[model samples]
Target: MTDGDLDATDPRTLPGFFDALADGKLLGGVCTDCGQVLLPPRPACYACGSRAVDVEPQSREGTVFSYTEVHTPPPAFAADAPYTVAVVELADGGRLLGRVAADYSDVAIGDSVELTVHEPTAAEREVALDYETDWPVHIFEPR
Candidate 1:
């Protein structure tokens, strides 16, 4: 689905998540019941299944937990074919999935990475912008 605009105030949804991303911040939901941090920022905590949660900013620094190459992406993202997706473990203790912009050969487990926002090309913006700022996608790069 295409998300043209994001709401920065509501971190429990994708709109808020992307809103935070555009503002140069990564966000997570903290479980009030079990104290577990949700990287994707869900309304309910996955561990304890509690709705009592708090939204907070996440550290931009993270270690590469895992990675894989996407040789054939869906049509909407075919322009970014052969890109790499990596699971980064945030310094505060949670995992986040993000697209890696660097070469696949340059990425490795345990590599250091930092959150970065990427703007789509003019063609991409004209076709289908994912969010505000003419389609800004969240990504990570080797730091």
Candidate 2:
């Protein structure tokens, strides 16, 4: 199956994340009880085991917690190899994992960044989060 051909409605599918993306927003789950934040959010909190989770709009602004340059990506991401992957700590105390953008040579731990979504190309026009153009890819740019 192609990247865009995968089923996106199922929570088990990454495309389900795109459902939020299509609306030009990014979503993360927050525990209703303890207020712990989750990225690539879950229906239940890993911390307090609460099923009363609520969707939260993540802050686009964050600081780089850590990063690494991957010379080799998985088969699916091979085309975007030699990329920087980062763990960013959002201002609201959440974290997100994603690519750091092409011009990221000067990045360092604790650098400030803001999120921006990128639309998929026509060739990748599937109804998944990876294919949503209307939804911006939550990429980090220097702040």
C-alpha local distance difference test of each model: 0.80, 0.71
Candidate 2: the clashing residue pairs are 18-129, 117-136, 117-137, 118-137
User: On a 0 to 1 TM-score scale, where does candidate 2 land against the true structure?
Assistant: 0.74
lDDT of 2 by residue, 1-143 (tens): 12233355633244676666556566777788999987766666899887776766777789999998988766656676788889999888888887787555888999988877767645334433534444445567777
TM-score of each: 0.80, 0.74
* lDDT (Cα, 0-100) at 58 in candidate 1: 83
lDDT, residue 114, candidate 2? 82
Summing lDDT over every window of 10 consecutive residues in candidate 1, give the lowest-scoring window: 1-10
**Backbone Cα, N, C clashes tallied per candidate:** 0, 4
Candidate 2 residue 90 Cα shift, in angstroms, is 0.8
Misplaced by over 4 Å in model 2 are 1-16, 102-104, 122-137
Candidate 1 stretches with Cα past 4 Å from truth are: 1-8, 123-135
What clash pairs does model 1 have?
none
